[model samples]
Target: MNDNSEIQDVELAVSRWLRIGVIISAAVIVIGLILLFIHGGSGYPDDYYPHSLSEIYSGTITLKPYAVITTGLILLILTPVLRVAISIWVFVREGDKLYVIITSIVLAILIISFILGKA
Candidate 1:
């Protein structure tokens, strides 16, 4: 169709992806909370806290409530990262070097923040 229509479609797709990410994240969080209440937490703080992404994934696979919660939190945190990545792609496709650079910087900062926070 027209350029405007194509642009709107891309925007709509991006929005839809964001909405899906949030909804899935929220659902996971709710399920985790429900499991926590039902099972009384994956044996409390004295037992364990997932130390890494892999651990959380493993825990989630094992149906550990805390892991499920952490999985949800991680998903929520990564949603914006995903969005930024998508935006960068869109900017590149539109040949907007300025925005691509800006979005890349933002993404870099996000990664740095996470790294620094862990350290």
Candidate 2:
């Protein structure tokens, strides 16, 4: 295939994945909100919320509304990171060394920040 069509294919795949991530995140948040209403609270003390990934995961497993909402928020935050990762893969497949290097740097920074932010 020509470069133009190849580019379009990449864009389409990226767009589709982004859309899916957003829709899933929104749906999860909505479910959490609905649960909050039904439960009449966030299932946590007032002004308190999960502070770590583990906490969030445990709470979500327990069906805590606040934890569920936090998980949705995390998904939303990671969507762009996923896009960056996909770009790295695409660049590698296309044998674009320069872009692959740049995208790899970006992905590394994103991952580093994500991990450091947890500290």
Which candidate wins on lDDT? 2
Q: 1-119 in candidate 1: lDDT tens per residue?
A: 69799799889989888899999999998999899899986834676688887888888988788999889888989998999999999999999999999999999999999988887
Q: After superposition, how far is residue 53 of candidate 2 from its true place, in Å?
A: 0.5
- TM-score, one value per model: 0.88, 0.94
The Cα local distance difference test for each model comes to: 0.89, 0.93
Candidate 2 clash pair list: none
Instruction: Please give the range of 10 consecutive residues that has the lowest summed lDDT in model 1.
Output: 40-49
Whose TM-score is greatest here? 2
